[model samples]
Target: MENKNKYIILTTMLIQSTLLIVINCTIIDTSTLEALKSSMPIFNIMILITTVLMLLSLKKANSFIKKETELELVKSNMKNTEDLLNLLRTQRHDYLSHIQAIESLIILKEQEELEEYIKGISKEYRITNEMIRLGNSVLTAIINTKKEIAEKKGIVFHVRCKNKVSLHGINSWELSSIISNLIENAIEEASSIENEKWIKITISYVYNNFVFEIENTRKINNEIGDNIFKPGVSSKNAAGRGYGLFIVKNVVEKYNGSIEFKTTEKNSIIFKVILPSEDGAYGEKAI
Candidate 1:
Protein backbone atom coordinates (compact mmCIF):
# COMPACT_ATOMS: atom_id res chain seq x y z
CA MET A 1 0.00 0.00 0.00
CA GLU A 2 2.83 2.36 0.79
CA ASN A 3 4.44 1.66 -2.54
CA LYS A 4 1.14 2.10 -4.33
CA ASN A 5 0.64 5.47 -2.67
CA LYS A 6 4.15 6.55 -3.65
CA TYR A 7 3.53 5.68 -7.30
CA ILE A 8 0.23 7.52 -7.22
CA ILE A 9 1.84 10.65 -5.78
CA LEU A 10 4.75 10.61 -8.25
CA THR A 11 2.50 10.05 -11.25
CA THR A 12 0.17 12.81 -10.12
CA MET A 13 3.06 15.22 -9.78
CA LEU A 14 4.34 14.35 -13.22
CA ILE A 15 0.89 14.82 -14.77
CA GLN A 16 0.41 18.14 -12.96
CA SER A 17 3.78 19.43 -14.10
CA THR A 18 3.08 18.42 -17.69
CA LEU A 19 -0.35 20.08 -17.60
CA LEU A 20 1.10 23.32 -16.17
CA ILE A 21 3.80 23.38 -18.82
CA VAL A 22 1.24 22.87 -21.60
CA ILE A 23 -1.01 25.58 -20.15
CA ASN A 24 1.90 28.03 -20.01
CA CYS A 25 2.81 27.26 -23.62
CA THR A 26 -0.77 27.73 -24.79
CA ILE A 27 -1.01 31.16 -23.10
CA ILE A 28 2.42 32.32 -24.36
CA ASP A 29 2.66 35.15 -27.00
CA THR A 30 2.67 33.40 -30.39
CA SER A 31 4.82 35.95 -32.19
CA THR A 32 7.51 35.93 -29.51
CA LEU A 33 7.93 32.15 -29.89
CA GLU A 34 8.09 32.14 -33.71
CA ALA A 35 11.87 32.41 -33.85
CA LEU A 36 12.31 29.55 -31.32
CA LYS A 37 10.00 27.02 -33.04
CA SER A 38 12.77 24.38 -33.43
CA SER A 39 13.84 24.85 -29.81
CA MET A 40 10.21 24.59 -28.66
CA PRO A 41 9.83 21.17 -30.36
CA ILE A 42 13.09 20.01 -28.82
CA PHE A 43 11.89 21.15 -25.39
CA ASN A 44 8.64 19.18 -25.78
CA ILE A 45 10.62 16.12 -26.88
CA MET A 46 12.81 16.42 -23.79
CA ILE A 47 9.71 16.51 -21.59
CA LEU A 48 8.36 13.38 -23.27
CA ILE A 49 11.70 11.63 -22.83
CA THR A 50 11.83 12.69 -19.18
CA THR A 51 8.33 11.32 -18.56
CA VAL A 52 9.24 7.99 -20.16
CA LEU A 53 12.42 7.80 -18.12
CA MET A 54 10.50 8.52 -14.92
CA LEU A 55 8.01 5.76 -15.69
CA LEU A 56 10.77 3.32 -16.52
CA SER A 57 12.48 4.23 -13.27
CA LEU A 58 9.31 3.50 -11.40
CA LYS A 59 9.04 0.13 -13.10
CA LYS A 60 12.62 -0.64 -12.18
CA ALA A 61 11.95 0.38 -8.61
CA ASN A 62 9.03 -2.04 -8.46
CA SER A 63 11.13 -4.79 -9.95
CA PHE A 64 13.82 -4.14 -7.39
CA ILE A 65 11.30 -4.37 -4.58
CA LYS A 66 10.09 -7.71 -5.88
CA LYS A 67 13.62 -9.04 -6.14
CA GLU A 68 14.30 -7.86 -2.61
CA THR A 69 11.36 -9.88 -1.29
CA GLU A 70 12.54 -12.95 -3.13
CA LEU A 71 16.03 -12.49 -1.79
CA GLU A 72 14.71 -12.30 1.73
CA LEU A 73 12.84 -15.57 1.19
CA VAL A 74 15.95 -17.19 -0.13
CA LYS A 75 17.93 -16.03 2.89
CA SER A 76 15.26 -17.34 5.22
CA ASN A 77 15.21 -20.71 3.48
CA MET A 78 18.97 -20.94 3.74
CA LYS A 79 18.85 -20.25 7.45
CA ASN A 80 16.17 -22.89 7.98
CA THR A 81 18.17 -25.36 5.93
CA GLU A 82 21.23 -24.67 7.99
CA ASP A 83 19.25 -25.19 11.18
CA LEU A 84 17.90 -28.49 9.91
CA LEU A 85 21.39 -29.64 9.05
CA ASN A 86 22.58 -28.75 12.52
CA LEU A 87 19.70 -30.68 14.01
CA LEU A 88 20.54 -33.72 11.93
CA ARG A 89 24.15 -33.54 12.94
CA THR A 90 23.23 -33.33 16.60
CA GLN A 91 20.96 -36.33 16.25
CA ARG A 92 23.65 -38.27 14.48
CA HIS A 93 26.13 -37.50 17.23
CA ASP A 94 23.64 -38.58 19.88
CA TYR A 95 22.97 -41.80 18.02
CA LEU A 96 26.48 -42.96 18.75
CA SER A 97 25.93 -42.50 22.46
CA HIS A 98 22.54 -44.18 22.17
CA ILE A 99 24.11 -47.15 20.47
CA GLN A 100 26.82 -47.33 23.12
CA ALA A 101 24.26 -47.22 25.90
CA ILE A 102 22.19 -49.92 24.24
CA GLU A 103 25.29 -52.07 23.85
CA SER A 104 26.17 -51.61 27.52
CA LEU A 105 22.64 -52.47 28.53
CA ILE A 106 22.72 -55.62 26.45
CA ILE A 107 26.14 -56.67 27.83
CA LEU A 108 24.88 -56.27 31.41
CA LYS A 109 21.78 -58.37 30.61
CA GLU A 110 19.49 -55.64 31.90
CA GLN A 111 16.43 -56.30 29.73
CA GLU A 112 13.94 -54.17 31.70
CA GLU A 113 16.22 -51.11 31.86
CA LEU A 114 17.03 -51.50 28.17
CA GLU A 115 13.33 -51.48 27.29
CA GLU A 116 12.67 -48.37 29.34
CA TYR A 117 15.66 -46.55 27.84
CA ILE A 118 14.57 -47.44 24.35
CA LYS A 119 11.03 -46.24 25.07
CA GLY A 120 12.31 -42.97 26.38
CA ILE A 121 14.58 -42.52 23.36
CA SER A 122 11.73 -43.32 21.01
CA LYS A 123 9.54 -40.80 22.81
CA GLU A 124 12.05 -38.06 22.12
CA TYR A 125 11.77 -38.66 18.36
CA ARG A 126 7.97 -38.74 18.37
CA ILE A 127 7.60 -35.00 17.96
CA THR A 128 10.22 -34.93 15.23
CA ASN A 129 8.34 -37.61 13.37
CA GLU A 130 5.09 -35.74 13.72
CA MET A 131 6.69 -32.56 12.45
CA ILE A 132 7.96 -34.40 9.39
CA ARG A 133 4.48 -35.78 8.87
CA LEU A 134 3.18 -32.24 8.49
CA GLY A 135 4.30 -32.64 4.83
CA ASN A 136 5.98 -29.26 4.79
CA SER A 137 9.72 -29.34 5.26
CA VAL A 138 9.96 -25.73 6.31
CA LEU A 139 7.34 -26.14 8.98
CA THR A 140 8.94 -29.30 10.22
CA ALA A 141 12.36 -27.72 10.46
CA ILE A 142 11.17 -24.61 12.25
CA ILE A 143 9.01 -26.50 14.71
CA ASN A 144 11.50 -29.24 15.43
CA THR A 145 14.30 -26.73 15.86
CA LYS A 146 12.28 -24.49 18.14
CA LYS A 147 11.03 -27.48 20.09
CA GLU A 148 14.58 -28.39 20.89
CA ILE A 149 15.26 -24.86 22.06
CA ALA A 150 12.15 -24.81 24.19
CA GLU A 151 12.86 -28.17 25.79
CA LYS A 152 16.38 -27.07 26.63
CA LYS A 153 14.91 -24.19 28.55
CA GLY A 154 12.69 -26.65 30.51
CA ILE A 155 9.59 -25.68 28.57
CA VAL A 156 7.26 -28.48 27.66
CA PHE A 157 6.69 -28.08 23.93
CA HIS A 158 3.77 -30.00 22.52
CA VAL A 159 2.41 -30.07 18.99
CA ARG A 160 -0.83 -31.45 17.54
CA CYS A 161 -2.08 -31.70 13.99
CA LYS A 162 -5.61 -32.58 12.95
CA ASN A 163 -4.47 -33.66 9.50
CA LYS A 164 -2.00 -32.97 6.78
CA VAL A 165 -2.28 -29.30 5.87
CA SER A 166 -1.88 -27.65 2.51
CA LEU A 167 -0.46 -24.15 2.34
CA HIS A 168 -2.06 -23.17 -0.90
CA GLY A 169 -0.91 -19.65 -1.76
CA ILE A 170 1.93 -19.27 0.74
CA ASN A 171 5.52 -20.29 0.17
CA SER A 172 7.88 -22.09 2.52
CA TRP A 173 9.81 -19.04 3.66
CA GLU A 174 6.67 -17.07 4.41
CA LEU A 175 5.50 -19.93 6.58
CA SER A 176 8.87 -20.00 8.27
CA SER A 177 8.80 -16.31 9.13
CA ILE A 178 5.29 -16.52 10.53
CA ILE A 179 5.63 -19.72 12.53
CA SER A 180 9.19 -19.21 13.67
CA ASN A 181 8.54 -15.75 14.95
CA LEU A 182 5.48 -16.79 16.92
CA ILE A 183 7.16 -19.84 18.42
CA GLU A 184 10.30 -17.89 19.20
CA ASN A 185 8.29 -15.34 21.10
CA ALA A 186 6.44 -18.08 22.92
CA ILE A 187 9.66 -19.71 23.95
CA GLU A 188 11.08 -16.42 25.14
CA GLU A 189 8.07 -15.59 27.29
CA ALA A 190 7.48 -19.08 28.62
CA SER A 191 11.09 -19.60 29.63
CA SER A 192 11.21 -16.41 31.66
CA ILE A 193 9.30 -17.68 34.69
CA GLU A 194 10.26 -20.18 37.40
CA ASN A 195 7.03 -22.14 37.45
CA GLU A 196 5.53 -24.65 35.06
CA LYS A 197 6.43 -23.53 31.53
CA TRP A 198 4.81 -24.98 28.45
CA ILE A 199 4.09 -24.22 24.79
CA LYS A 200 1.40 -25.96 22.76
CA ILE A 201 1.11 -25.77 18.98
CA THR A 202 -1.92 -26.97 17.07
CA ILE A 203 -2.30 -27.07 13.29
CA SER A 204 -5.35 -27.91 11.21
CA TYR A 205 -7.02 -27.19 7.92
CA VAL A 206 -10.58 -26.03 8.35
CA TYR A 207 -13.07 -24.91 5.73
CA ASN A 208 -10.49 -23.80 3.17
CA ASN A 209 -8.28 -22.21 5.77
CA PHE A 210 -5.05 -23.51 7.22
CA VAL A 211 -5.08 -22.76 10.91
CA PHE A 212 -2.24 -22.54 13.40
CA GLU A 213 -2.88 -22.18 17.09
CA ILE A 214 0.12 -21.59 19.35
CA GLU A 215 -0.53 -21.35 23.04
CA ASN A 216 2.10 -20.41 25.56
CA THR A 217 1.82 -20.02 29.30
CA ARG A 218 2.24 -16.33 29.98
CA LYS A 219 0.29 -13.48 31.46
CA ILE A 220 0.00 -10.50 29.14
CA ASN A 221 0.05 -7.20 30.91
CA ASN A 222 -1.49 -3.92 29.80
CA GLU A 223 1.72 -2.34 28.51
CA ILE A 224 2.60 -5.28 26.23
CA GLY A 225 -0.99 -5.84 25.17
CA ASP A 226 -1.50 -2.30 23.98
CA ASN A 227 1.35 -2.31 21.43
CA ILE A 228 2.14 -5.96 20.98
CA PHE A 229 1.84 -5.77 17.24
CA LYS A 230 3.81 -2.59 16.91
CA PRO A 231 7.48 -2.67 15.96
CA GLY A 232 10.00 -2.13 18.75
CA VAL A 233 7.41 -2.76 21.48
CA SER A 234 8.63 -5.80 23.36
CA SER A 235 7.98 -7.15 26.79
CA LYS A 236 11.71 -7.69 27.10
CA ASN A 237 13.86 -4.67 27.76
CA ALA A 238 16.87 -5.78 25.74
CA ALA A 239 18.12 -3.98 22.65
CA GLY A 240 16.65 -5.19 19.32
CA ARG A 241 14.08 -7.09 21.33
CA GLY A 242 10.86 -6.62 19.39
CA TYR A 243 9.45 -6.79 15.81
CA GLY A 244 8.48 -10.48 15.71
CA LEU A 245 4.74 -9.90 15.68
CA PHE A 246 5.09 -6.95 13.36
CA ILE A 247 6.70 -9.18 10.74
CA VAL A 248 4.22 -11.99 11.34
CA LYS A 249 1.30 -9.58 10.96
CA ASN A 250 2.69 -8.27 7.70
CA VAL A 251 3.30 -11.70 6.21
CA VAL A 252 -0.11 -12.95 7.28
CA GLU A 253 -1.79 -9.90 5.70
CA LYS A 254 0.27 -10.35 2.56
CA TYR A 255 -1.53 -13.61 1.84
CA ASN A 256 -4.95 -12.23 2.72
CA GLY A 257 -4.84 -14.05 6.02
CA SER A 258 -5.74 -12.97 9.53
CA ILE A 259 -3.94 -13.43 12.84
CA GLU A 260 -5.38 -12.93 16.28
CA PHE A 261 -4.91 -14.07 19.82
CA LYS A 262 -6.71 -14.32 23.12
CA THR A 263 -5.72 -14.81 26.71
CA THR A 264 -7.10 -17.95 28.25
CA GLU A 265 -8.62 -18.06 31.72
CA LYS A 266 -5.45 -19.76 32.95
CA ASN A 267 -3.34 -16.82 31.76
CA SER A 268 -2.04 -18.54 28.69
CA ILE A 269 -1.74 -16.77 25.32
CA ILE A 270 -2.96 -18.49 22.19
CA PHE A 271 -2.12 -17.04 18.78
CA LYS A 272 -4.30 -18.20 15.92
CA VAL A 273 -3.51 -17.75 12.23
CA ILE A 274 -5.89 -18.62 9.41
CA LEU A 275 -4.84 -18.61 5.76
CA PRO A 276 -6.98 -19.48 2.75
CA SER A 277 -6.26 -22.87 1.26
CA GLU A 278 -6.52 -24.28 -2.24
CA ASP A 279 -8.45 -27.36 -1.17
CA GLY A 280 -11.74 -26.51 0.52
CA ALA A 281 -12.90 -29.85 1.78
CA TYR A 282 -12.25 -29.57 5.49
CA GLY A 283 -14.91 -28.66 8.06
CA GLU A 284 -14.60 -25.93 10.62
CA LYS A 285 -13.56 -26.84 14.16
CA ALA A 286 -12.41 -25.04 17.28
CA ILE A 287 -8.69 -24.67 17.85
Candidate 2:
Protein backbone atom coordinates (compact mmCIF):
# COMPACT_ATOMS: atom_id res chain seq x y z
CA MET A 1 0.00 0.00 0.00
CA GLU A 2 2.77 2.45 0.83
CA ASN A 3 4.67 1.78 -2.39
CA LYS A 4 1.44 2.03 -4.35
CA ASN A 5 0.74 5.42 -2.83
CA LYS A 6 4.26 6.59 -3.64
CA TYR A 7 3.85 5.53 -7.26
CA ILE A 8 0.55 7.37 -7.53
CA ILE A 9 2.09 10.54 -6.11
CA LEU A 10 5.04 10.32 -8.47
CA THR A 11 2.80 9.82 -11.50
CA THR A 12 0.59 12.73 -10.51
CA MET A 13 3.64 15.02 -10.12
CA LEU A 14 5.02 13.91 -13.50
CA ILE A 15 1.75 14.70 -15.27
CA GLN A 16 1.41 18.06 -13.51
CA SER A 17 4.99 19.11 -14.34
CA THR A 18 4.57 18.12 -17.98
CA LEU A 19 1.36 20.12 -18.32
CA LEU A 20 2.95 23.13 -16.57
CA ILE A 21 5.96 23.02 -18.88
CA VAL A 22 3.73 22.81 -21.97
CA ILE A 23 1.55 25.71 -20.76
CA ASN A 24 4.62 27.92 -20.02
CA CYS A 25 6.20 27.22 -23.41
CA THR A 26 2.93 28.16 -25.20
CA ILE A 27 2.61 31.35 -23.15
CA ILE A 28 6.25 32.30 -23.81
CA ASP A 29 5.69 32.05 -27.56
CA THR A 30 2.18 33.62 -27.93
CA SER A 31 1.89 36.18 -25.10
CA THR A 32 3.60 39.49 -24.23
CA LEU A 33 6.43 39.47 -21.65
CA GLU A 34 4.18 41.35 -19.15
CA ALA A 35 1.34 38.86 -19.68
CA LEU A 36 3.68 35.86 -19.11
CA LYS A 37 5.05 37.56 -15.97
CA SER A 38 1.53 37.96 -14.62
CA SER A 39 0.81 34.21 -15.25
CA MET A 40 4.03 33.15 -13.42
CA PRO A 41 2.60 34.14 -10.04
CA ILE A 42 -0.40 31.91 -10.62
CA PHE A 43 1.91 29.01 -11.44
CA ASN A 44 3.96 29.76 -8.34
CA ILE A 45 0.84 29.71 -6.20
CA MET A 46 -0.24 26.38 -7.68
CA ILE A 47 3.15 24.82 -6.89
CA LEU A 48 3.04 26.22 -3.34
CA ILE A 49 -0.40 24.80 -2.72
CA THR A 50 0.60 21.34 -4.06
CA THR A 51 3.74 21.31 -1.93
CA VAL A 52 1.81 22.26 1.23
CA LEU A 53 -0.86 19.62 0.59
CA MET A 54 1.76 16.95 -0.03
CA LEU A 55 3.52 17.87 3.19
CA LEU A 56 0.30 17.65 5.14
CA SER A 57 -0.49 14.27 3.61
CA LEU A 58 2.97 12.98 4.51
CA LYS A 59 2.54 14.19 8.11
CA LYS A 60 -0.79 12.46 8.43
CA ALA A 61 0.63 9.26 7.02
CA ASN A 62 3.43 9.27 9.62
CA SER A 63 0.95 9.92 12.42
CA PHE A 64 -1.23 7.05 11.27
CA ILE A 65 1.71 4.68 11.22
CA LYS A 66 2.67 5.68 14.76
CA LYS A 67 -0.85 5.12 16.03
CA GLU A 68 -1.05 1.75 14.30
CA THR A 69 2.09 0.58 16.07
CA GLU A 70 0.76 1.83 19.42
CA LEU A 71 -2.53 0.09 18.82
CA GLU A 72 -0.77 -3.22 18.21
CA LEU A 73 1.11 -2.88 21.48
CA VAL A 74 -2.06 -2.10 23.36
CA LYS A 75 -3.76 -5.13 21.89
CA SER A 76 -0.89 -7.37 22.87
CA ASN A 77 -0.92 -6.12 26.47
CA MET A 78 -4.64 -6.62 26.73
CA LYS A 79 -4.41 -10.19 25.46
CA ASN A 80 -1.71 -11.00 27.98
CA THR A 81 -3.82 -9.57 30.81
CA GLU A 82 -6.83 -11.55 29.69
CA ASP A 83 -4.83 -14.77 29.56
CA LEU A 84 -3.57 -14.11 33.07
CA LEU A 85 -7.09 -13.62 34.37
CA ASN A 86 -8.32 -16.76 32.71
CA LEU A 87 -5.46 -18.76 34.17
CA LEU A 88 -6.29 -17.36 37.59
CA ARG A 89 -9.87 -18.52 37.26
CA THR A 90 -8.76 -21.97 36.20
CA GLN A 91 -6.43 -22.16 39.17
CA ARG A 92 -9.27 -21.19 41.47
CA HIS A 93 -11.33 -24.09 40.21
CA ASP A 94 -8.37 -26.41 40.55
CA TYR A 95 -7.90 -25.28 44.15
CA LEU A 96 -11.47 -26.14 44.97
CA SER A 97 -11.09 -29.60 43.49
CA HIS A 98 -7.86 -30.03 45.42
CA ILE A 99 -9.61 -29.14 48.66
CA GLN A 100 -12.37 -31.62 47.96
CA ALA A 101 -9.88 -34.35 47.19
CA ILE A 102 -7.96 -33.71 50.38
CA GLU A 103 -11.13 -33.81 52.44
CA SER A 104 -12.07 -37.11 50.85
CA LEU A 105 -8.66 -38.59 51.51
CA ILE A 106 -8.86 -37.47 55.14
CA ILE A 107 -12.32 -38.99 55.54
CA LEU A 108 -11.10 -42.26 54.06
CA LYS A 109 -8.15 -42.29 56.54
CA GLU A 110 -5.60 -42.78 53.75
CA GLN A 111 -2.61 -41.46 55.67
CA GLU A 112 0.17 -42.42 53.23
CA GLU A 113 -1.72 -41.27 50.11
CA LEU A 114 -2.74 -38.02 51.79
CA GLU A 115 0.87 -37.31 52.74
CA GLU A 116 1.98 -37.93 49.15
CA TYR A 117 -0.86 -35.85 47.74
CA ILE A 118 -0.08 -32.93 50.05
CA LYS A 119 3.59 -33.06 49.07
CA GLY A 120 2.72 -32.99 45.40
CA ILE A 121 0.40 -30.05 45.86
CA SER A 122 3.05 -28.18 47.83
CA LYS A 123 5.60 -28.63 45.05
CA GLU A 124 3.13 -27.46 42.41
CA TYR A 125 2.19 -24.43 44.48
CA ARG A 126 5.85 -23.55 44.92
CA ILE A 127 6.35 -23.33 41.18
CA THR A 128 3.24 -21.23 40.76
CA ASN A 129 4.32 -18.96 43.60
CA GLU A 130 7.74 -18.48 42.07
CA MET A 131 6.19 -17.48 38.75
CA ILE A 132 3.87 -15.01 40.48
CA ARG A 133 6.81 -13.59 42.40
CA LEU A 134 8.54 -12.66 39.16
CA GLY A 135 6.90 -9.26 39.89
CA ASN A 136 5.87 -8.67 36.28
CA SER A 137 2.33 -9.68 35.47
CA VAL A 138 2.94 -9.50 31.73
CA LEU A 139 5.82 -11.93 31.85
CA THR A 140 4.00 -14.32 34.13
CA ALA A 141 0.89 -14.31 31.97
CA ILE A 142 2.70 -14.81 28.67
CA ILE A 143 4.81 -17.65 30.02
CA ASN A 144 1.88 -19.34 31.70
CA THR A 145 -0.26 -19.09 28.60
CA LYS A 146 2.49 -20.40 26.36
CA LYS A 147 3.20 -23.21 28.77
CA GLU A 148 -0.40 -24.27 28.71
CA ILE A 149 -0.41 -24.20 24.94
CA ALA A 150 2.77 -26.24 24.74
CA GLU A 151 1.43 -28.82 27.16
CA LYS A 152 -1.81 -29.16 25.22
CA LYS A 153 0.25 -29.86 22.13
CA GLY A 154 2.12 -32.68 23.90
CA ILE A 155 5.20 -30.54 24.36
CA VAL A 156 6.72 -30.40 27.79
CA PHE A 157 7.37 -26.83 28.92
CA HIS A 158 9.68 -26.09 31.80
CA VAL A 159 10.40 -22.69 33.35
CA ARG A 160 13.12 -21.92 35.86
CA CYS A 161 13.35 -18.67 37.76
CA LYS A 162 15.16 -18.45 41.07
CA ASN A 163 15.07 -14.77 41.84
CA LYS A 164 12.67 -11.85 41.71
CA VAL A 165 13.51 -10.55 38.25
CA SER A 166 12.31 -7.10 37.31
CA LEU A 167 12.24 -5.08 34.12
CA HIS A 168 12.48 -1.49 35.33
CA GLY A 169 12.81 0.36 32.05
CA ILE A 170 10.71 -1.79 29.76
CA ASN A 171 6.96 -1.45 29.42
CA SER A 172 4.56 -4.38 29.78
CA TRP A 173 3.65 -4.36 26.10
CA GLU A 174 7.21 -4.56 24.83
CA LEU A 175 8.15 -7.16 27.40
CA SER A 176 5.10 -9.19 26.45
CA SER A 177 6.02 -9.14 22.76
CA ILE A 178 9.58 -10.20 23.40
CA ILE A 179 8.90 -13.09 25.75
CA SER A 180 5.65 -14.26 24.19
CA ASN A 181 6.94 -14.29 20.63
CA LEU A 182 10.04 -16.26 21.52
CA ILE A 183 8.21 -18.84 23.60
CA GLU A 184 5.40 -19.18 21.11
CA ASN A 185 7.93 -19.88 18.39
CA ALA A 186 9.58 -22.45 20.57
CA ILE A 187 6.26 -24.15 21.25
CA GLU A 188 5.40 -24.25 17.58
CA GLU A 189 8.73 -25.76 16.65
CA ALA A 190 8.68 -28.27 19.46
CA SER A 191 5.16 -29.36 18.64
CA SER A 192 6.04 -30.10 15.05
CA ILE A 193 8.22 -33.02 16.01
CA GLU A 194 6.74 -36.44 16.81
CA ASN A 195 9.17 -37.39 19.52
CA GLU A 196 11.27 -35.68 22.16
CA LYS A 197 9.08 -32.59 22.06
CA TRP A 198 9.88 -30.20 24.86
CA ILE A 199 10.58 -26.52 25.59
CA LYS A 200 12.67 -25.13 28.41
CA ILE A 201 12.64 -21.48 29.45
CA THR A 202 14.92 -19.91 31.99
CA ILE A 203 14.56 -16.37 33.38
CA SER A 204 17.22 -14.81 35.52
CA TYR A 205 18.80 -11.52 36.51
CA VAL A 206 22.52 -11.51 35.99
CA TYR A 207 25.06 -8.68 36.07
CA ASN A 208 22.39 -5.95 36.04
CA ASN A 209 20.70 -7.52 33.08
CA PHE A 210 17.54 -9.56 32.67
CA VAL A 211 18.13 -12.78 30.78
CA PHE A 212 15.52 -14.84 28.94
CA GLU A 213 16.62 -18.14 27.47
CA ILE A 214 14.30 -20.54 25.65
CA GLU A 215 15.36 -23.90 24.28
CA ASN A 216 13.31 -26.40 22.33
CA THR A 217 13.69 -29.58 20.41
CA ARG A 218 13.87 -28.77 16.71
CA LYS A 219 15.46 -30.24 13.64
CA ILE A 220 17.88 -27.97 11.87
CA ASN A 221 16.24 -26.04 9.06
CA ASN A 222 19.10 -24.78 6.94
CA GLU A 223 16.79 -22.38 5.13
CA ILE A 224 16.76 -20.16 8.24
CA GLY A 225 20.56 -20.02 8.51
CA ASP A 226 21.78 -16.67 9.82
CA ASN A 227 18.81 -14.61 8.65
CA ILE A 228 16.29 -16.02 11.13
CA PHE A 229 15.69 -12.59 12.57
CA LYS A 230 15.15 -10.95 9.22
CA PRO A 231 11.66 -10.02 8.09
CA GLY A 232 9.84 -12.38 5.73
CA VAL A 233 12.14 -15.28 6.54
CA SER A 234 10.58 -18.39 8.00
CA SER A 235 10.99 -22.14 8.05
CA LYS A 236 7.26 -22.41 7.64
CA ASN A 237 5.91 -21.80 4.15
CA ALA A 238 2.81 -19.91 5.22
CA ALA A 239 2.13 -16.24 4.70
CA GLY A 240 2.82 -13.92 7.66
CA ARG A 241 4.89 -16.61 9.34
CA GLY A 242 8.22 -14.89 9.93
CA TYR A 243 7.64 -11.42 11.38
CA GLY A 244 7.59 -12.51 15.02
CA LEU A 245 11.33 -12.92 15.36
CA PHE A 246 11.93 -9.79 13.35
CA ILE A 247 9.78 -7.74 15.71
CA VAL A 248 11.44 -9.39 18.69
CA LYS A 249 14.87 -8.45 17.38
CA ASN A 250 13.81 -4.87 16.73
CA VAL A 251 12.41 -4.44 20.26
CA VAL A 252 15.49 -6.04 21.80
CA GLU A 253 17.84 -3.80 19.82
CA LYS A 254 15.75 -0.74 20.58
CA TYR A 255 16.72 -1.22 24.22
CA ASN A 256 20.38 -1.87 23.40
CA GLY A 257 19.73 -5.53 24.13
CA SER A 258 21.17 -8.52 22.31
CA ILE A 259 19.59 -11.74 21.00
CA GLU A 260 21.40 -14.84 19.80
CA PHE A 261 20.45 -18.39 18.97
CA LYS A 262 22.39 -21.61 18.76
CA THR A 263 21.59 -25.18 17.80
CA THR A 264 22.77 -27.93 20.10
CA GLU A 265 24.30 -31.21 19.03
CA LYS A 266 21.28 -32.86 20.65
CA ASN A 267 19.03 -31.44 17.94
CA SER A 268 17.71 -28.59 20.06
CA ILE A 269 17.67 -24.82 19.44
CA ILE A 270 18.11 -22.15 22.10
CA PHE A 271 17.43 -18.45 21.87
CA LYS A 272 18.87 -16.11 24.47
CA VAL A 273 17.91 -12.50 25.03
CA ILE A 274 19.82 -10.15 27.33
CA LEU A 275 18.48 -6.72 28.22
CA PRO A 276 19.77 -4.17 30.66
CA SER A 277 17.80 -3.75 33.86
CA GLU A 278 18.07 0.01 33.63
CA ASP A 279 17.47 2.03 30.51
CA GLY A 280 20.12 1.81 27.82
CA ALA A 281 21.89 5.01 26.85
CA TYR A 282 19.72 5.45 23.77
CA GLY A 283 16.62 3.56 24.88
CA GLU A 284 13.28 5.00 25.91
CA LYS A 285 13.00 5.35 29.69
CA ALA A 286 9.26 5.20 29.94
CA ILE A 287 7.58 2.29 31.69
lDDT of each: 0.80, 0.79
Off by over 4 Å in 1: 1-33, 93-132, 238-241, 281-287
Candidate 1: minimum summed lDDT over ten consecutive residues — where?
Answer: 278-287
Query: What CA RMSD would candidate 1 show?
Result: 6.5
TM-score of each: 0.75, 0.73
Which candidate leads in TM-score? 1
Give per-residue CA lDDT, model 1, range 1-287, as digits (tens).
35554565467568658766865776574555565574567667767866776777677678878768768876876687788778777777888899999999999999999999999998976655555446667787787788878988999988887866667568788888899889989998899878979999999876778899999998877678868888998888889877889989999998999999889988799999988886664443322
Candidate 1 C-alpha error for residue 240, in Å: 4.0
TM-score of 2: 0.73
After TM-score superposition, the amount by which residue 107's alpha carbon in candidate 2 deviates from its true location, in angstroms, is: 6.5
Q: For candidate 1, list the clashing residue pairs, or say none.
A: none
lDDT tens string, model 2, 1-287?
45455554565577568758867686868657777777777777777766765675676668778767768987987897797687777777789899999999999999999999999998766535644435567777787777767777999888787555567788678888898889888988898898899998887777778788999999658768689999999989899789999989999999899999999999999999998988323222211
